[model samples]
Target: MPSDPNRKIDIECDVAVIGAGTAGLAAERSARRAGARTLLIDDRFAGTTCASVGCMPSKLLIAAANVAHGIHGAPQFGIHADKVTIDGKAVMNRVRTLRDEFVSSARESIEDLPDGAKLKGKAKFINRDRLEVAGKIVHARSVVIATGSSPSIPETFDGMNNILTNETVFELDDLPSSLAVIGAGPLGLELAQAFSRLGVEVIVFDEGDAVAALKDEDIARTLRGLLEREFAIHLGVKVRASQTGQTIELAWSGESDGKKRFTHVLVAAGRLPNLQDLNLASAGLDLDEHGTPAFDRRTMQCGQSSIFLAGDCDADVPVLHEASAEGAIAGNNAARHPDIRPSKRSTPLAITFTDPPSASIGAPASEDTIVGVADFSDQGRAKVEAKNAGMIRIYADETGKLTGAAMAAPQGEHLAHLVAWAIEDGLTAMQLLDKPFYHPTYEEGLRSALRQICSQSQVSFGPDRDEGSVPGV
Candidate 1:
């Protein structure tokens, strides 16, 4: 088809997705699967930070840091390392290369969309079922608001020029000699560990009880111990103010003492949605007091049925996986329109990529008689690789059903996926115990944890048990 230059190029689609992020991409894919014409748009590059600057680049840095740690500590594994040094600049170069590769791949994916799928520049809502993109008005039967978020910067901080957000961290050519990570959430802790291992003087501060505050206490305690033992951690501390005119001036108050101190501060507190630029009021939508789009949970529909919310822009958990899941649900339903059916979302599987990495699935915490542990020290492969530094914990009910689980180890991220599958599939503790797991693999840790749980259960309800022996029975 030849270009229609004089036609204003205004297009129509069954569904129009506003962000080309993980959720937006998943939504587009689902829309195509449902045979809907989908048009995806973004203000910057189509893909969000996870692909361009956030998760992808951060994990690359983590992997490089881990390699440096392993090489520097090789003597303990009976390997001779007469010379062990990490070139910080070189490591950062590799991180940049990897991030560029991801950006390229994301661009290719967007360009390769099928005929029914189209990509465009900045899109703003003109009215319900209508959006203005690149000076042209496009109409859709339904719209999906997947516009993602950005780092939330404190207004009191004066050194905005020196301070950097997750989106800008990957652009650094050299690492800072000393870094003060302001928030102790997953992002803060992850970066602190990575930078500390890479020879940066890292001081992490958290006003919350601990990093990953929403996680279980035991996990938080274990992670706190690991970070404190390896890096500097200051909990229950608040940054009163910061000035970046020359040396970063940080005014902070610690919990125990009301005394204040000054230091260089790096703020990683949290993120706010990118709602202002969208001109949502033009489409008859208003943000809640918290500035998030107030929408129906189940349907994700905004004030108007044709406008659906997805990703961090909405009030759901700001996880890439959750965003993608919501995007697909919202996109598919919008594309199908009148014939739409209810979409179901299973429990979210997530992880914190620290030195040991922490993975979790299902409810926040599990209270059951059946608890299991699999230390990395016992894993034959981890032992062989000399990376035995963490453990896997599992919780189950009285019926031997898997409830919730978490793992801290080099394979924490990978192992968490399997546990997530087991929990989501409703596999009982005994069933997982019987399932075959390959030897000399991180997955063996799963078998080890379940085996321990079985032994504990057996010991509790031993062979000598009689019908009248236990009060519960």
Candidate 2:
């Protein structure tokens, strides 16, 4: 293969996938399994987003920070010990060591693809049915766009290169003494809390009042208070930053005013889809008002039947699992001689890896839904662990079917998974109550919320009712 963009070489495949990230890898594997002669293309074969930077690495760092935090707070258990010291460099090295293992595992999964099955190049649409990649033209029956996304750095902070995003933050060999994290979204909150626990003087600024896109107001408020006790949180604040000699100066408005300096600034504002180099207009696809390609979220199909999209490029959901599911749907549909029936979408699950993690599953709060809440302040397991600091809120439809849930509590990630599964399986509040829960466990809080909802339901429950029976049995 030549680097020259003008050199012409023609290749053909039943399915052509762009970008070798999570969604692209999934699409390529699915398309091949569907019997398509798939050609996977990307400018680089770096590991999937989760393994490389997004989920896995962040969680590793959070795990290390949590250990340090636990030791510092160990006196609450009446176990007096010597002062705990943290080695920032050693902690980060451990995170990187484990992160590299995850990335290597992901890379190994696709290493066996045949020589001609994959191409390294930046691909652009020659048309709906063809793409130009590494000076080679690929003609394919169906095309999948899985270019993923990049950190969204605003133009105002263009010249200062010391700013960190999730993409680069984990690579730090030594932690900064002070950090100013802009945005209270999952990435921002998770990293802020992680660093704060590891002894960084963290200051968080979010334009929105909520943290991690939490829908339940009470949970959001509780989370804000909990995080504020650990770090300086300035919510509903508009922030501007500039490099000031050896430090970064942050000026904000809203709850507070004036300027502060930090050793480093982290911009976890959001993400932008990697769409610019695709030349999507050549394929006759128009971008939406948000500047993302027009695609049906349910089917992951672009405006043209032959073109499809998955993962961050779709811009509907950015989680790794959601991207993987969308990739399967897009790949199956693209590879099928005549398109198969559309697959059902998975229940939405979002988790922030902060201490007393916050999570939301399925639909957000709305007028039609009944809400139930359980505070962790008195939760048995949480109290025993000295981690009782938040709450769990569940929502059900008028008919009592579980619809959604939001939680800011210890082991919330596990609870969110249970709620998401139940909602996906169409379980009702009463039905969820029937499932056996261990005594004095974190799940008991979830059961309490379910009981509250069931008690309020117009339909009576009975042992005779089946697993997903409606409110009245």
Candidate 3:
């Protein structure tokens, strides 16, 4: 038999995964485990975003900054340090080293796969069931898109020389003398505090009224005020930016209006899904108002088709854990297409790493909801450590079941998890109060709020009225 002239490959796979980020790796692994001939494809072969730039690298920098901040605040405990300094080079060296280790671990997973099960170029859909990668052709029963997202930069600020996004900020030789951060979201606020505490004059700007995307007006107000004392932050107004010479000038129109030039500007405004290179039109997927493919959130199925979408590309919940869970759903379902089964998503939870970290779980309770609040200033443990600041709010239904909670308190991350578990288990505020809370601990603060909630919730379990919802995440 003679070979066909148009044939580029004899590849036939049960699943084809695009991109090699956290979600893509998960999908490929899951599909392969399900006895499918999965072909993993990636352009750069980089690892998870958290390990590379999003979480680990940023937290490493925050850890160093917090150490410097702790030494400066030692006088509160009647302990004075003669001198404190942060070695910028040393700080970055550690971040890069640990980050590389994570990337290397991810590479090992790819290396374990057979050579025929992986592809090393960009893939574009040639038709409904076939893809053209580089110059080769592949036929797959189902496709999983996990290309992830990239930093979103405003068009007006394009082609500027002094602009640095999260993608490029960590590569700097040393911290900038002065830095201006755009966007007061989680990523922006985290980096702003890190830079400011490390001796960089940092200012943050965001048009939104809230910080860290907090919906509870009470918590948002308190957290914003606390963060303001730590560094200069301007919110609730548009920011004007331009480049001149070797620096960038930032200006905002508001009560705190001023134009200042900075050595570099970090843009954490938002992230855009990485779908442009895939030529989505060839796949013939149904598009929504934004020209994005319409898909079921629970099933990850695109327009009742075999193709699945996952991770940051869907922009549903961009957190790392959420990405992994979504990947598993898309992967497993793709292995058995046309028989999609909806999977229940866990109770929504989000946290922003700051001095007194901000956290939110589930959604706000209904109109008949009873709210409980705990002020850290009055808490025993907080006062003893001089970290007494911020507030925690818990919302319960009339039957005393915990619907959601929000906090900008010390150790809010741990508190958020405890609340999430209660919500997941359908435990009422009264039931949570039944559990013992140790003395003088931050968890006690949570119990304080739960007690307040139980006080207002006297009715028995009943039918629903309002479906609580979370915003901006």
Candidate 4:
């Protein structure tokens, strides 16, 4: 007899991937390419965090703030302009419009998949190799868990209103009269500065004294000083919030304690993975004290089982590039199951999108590594741009391999990439110095820092000496 049309059915595939976010999409594609019948599942077909409400929208807001900032600072260059006005509604409208385009592009990839290969529903593990999606059963030889993550609201924020996370902040119809940003991390500080520049009365509060997780003391101090010039930052304290009518009252206790009220509070503390509904216990994997399963980060595998974990689920590195790399690794491994491929992760690189910007690359320095310093306060390019408030430190091992570096410098994003590439390629400071260094450029600051490491390591600059180069010589 034929099966009833109203009844659910069981389906089988070589691989089942949970979540269709950035990492999940990559995993599904990679698994299919490896000759596996793959199934991709998501709670909803929303675009990636980067395109939907994270990087793209945040950058759009920053771009608008930068234009207003430039106009305000034009007088320093002896340039004058009439009164500048920022239409908050128009700015947010453009952000949402362009952001939707990016999200639509990401959605196209999943839409192109066969209807049977994609399912729109939450996936729960019935067993090690079985997932129950809606009423249908999906049995797979291997499974990849890449559910991504979501904004983590504190317990104190429960039942609270007018609180904004990175995901919800971009949806605002217009800028608020005031914003209280809770956290001095990258996300918090970036938005705090952007909103301040765009005429929002902003105050940042953080339990930690430092900004953006920088390890270097000097760089952090320099960055904090520069930022303080723009707005207030209260650190070394825990802030409690209470709603009062249309305002949110924030109270903090520390060296300097005070209470301030704002129209809204932005919680940029961090993000947590979405795993509550997965019913992980059914997988029967050995779980950690935190309930996370033990897995090899390099292979993205969970113990000896065919199940794999990737992306923000591991919470090891939450950056987009790291997510993509981990997704590919997990996908290929899930497709090949009992025989996983060798995986080599690249050097770590991170950037904070501040006005002058800040970046960190590779690992932090140990006592044995020599350090090189550059003060962009005297940098020609920075002075010319009127953004001379910056510093950089380069770390190299005794053998001169560029191990790590930290910077609160202008164009540090580009500098961090160069340093990361050099570290990844095992290029020593002197070897990198052998390359060209343009005059009157921000990269010259990098050369300055590299020279210090080379000098400390007794490595000589052969030819094309940066200092010897003269214009029109």
Q: Top model by lDDT, which number?
A: 4
Clashing pairs in 2: none
What lDDT score goes with residue 452 in model 4?
81
Model 4, global lDDT = 0.87
When sorted by TM-score, best at the front, the candidate numbers are 4, 2, 3, 1
TM-scores for every predicted model: 0.86, 0.94, 0.94, 0.95
TM-score: model 1 vs. ground truth: 0.86
> What does the lDDT read for residue 376 in candidate 2?
83
Which 10 residues in a row give candidate 3 its minimum summed lDDT?
464-473
- In order, how many clashes per candidate? 1, 0, 0, 0
lDDT, candidate 3, 206-265, per-residue tens: 877778988888998888889989888898767777888888887788656788999988
Residue-level lDDT of model 1, residues 1-473, one tens digit each, is 32233444378888888888887887788887889888887766545668786789999999988887887888887888767677888888999888888888888878788774675678876766677787777888888888887788777674445576687777778887777787988888888888888888777777777675436666677777767877867788776654545446555577633323323346688888877767676677767887666776666666556778888878577888788778878877787776656666776777888877887777655454477777666567777776666767787776667878866676788878877888888987777755665655777667656756666564333464221211110
Q: Write the per-residue lDDT of candidate 2 for residues 1-473, one digit (tens) a residue.
A: 32333445599899999988889988988999999999999898888999999899999989988888888888888877788888999999998999999999988866878778998899998777888887778888999999999998877678885788999999999888899998899999999999999999999987887788887888888888888899988888888888877688889998788699898888899898999988877888878987688877777787656888999977788898889998888888889835655788988899988878899899988987788888888777887788877988999987789999888899999989999999999999987887887766888778667867877777665777433422111
Which digits, one per residue and each the tens of the lDDT, describe model 4 over residues 44-140? Answer: 8898888998888899889999999999999999999999988999989999999999999999998999779988788888788888887788889
* TM-score, predicted candidate 4 vs. hidden true structure: 0.95
lDDT, each prediction: 0.73, 0.85, 0.85, 0.87
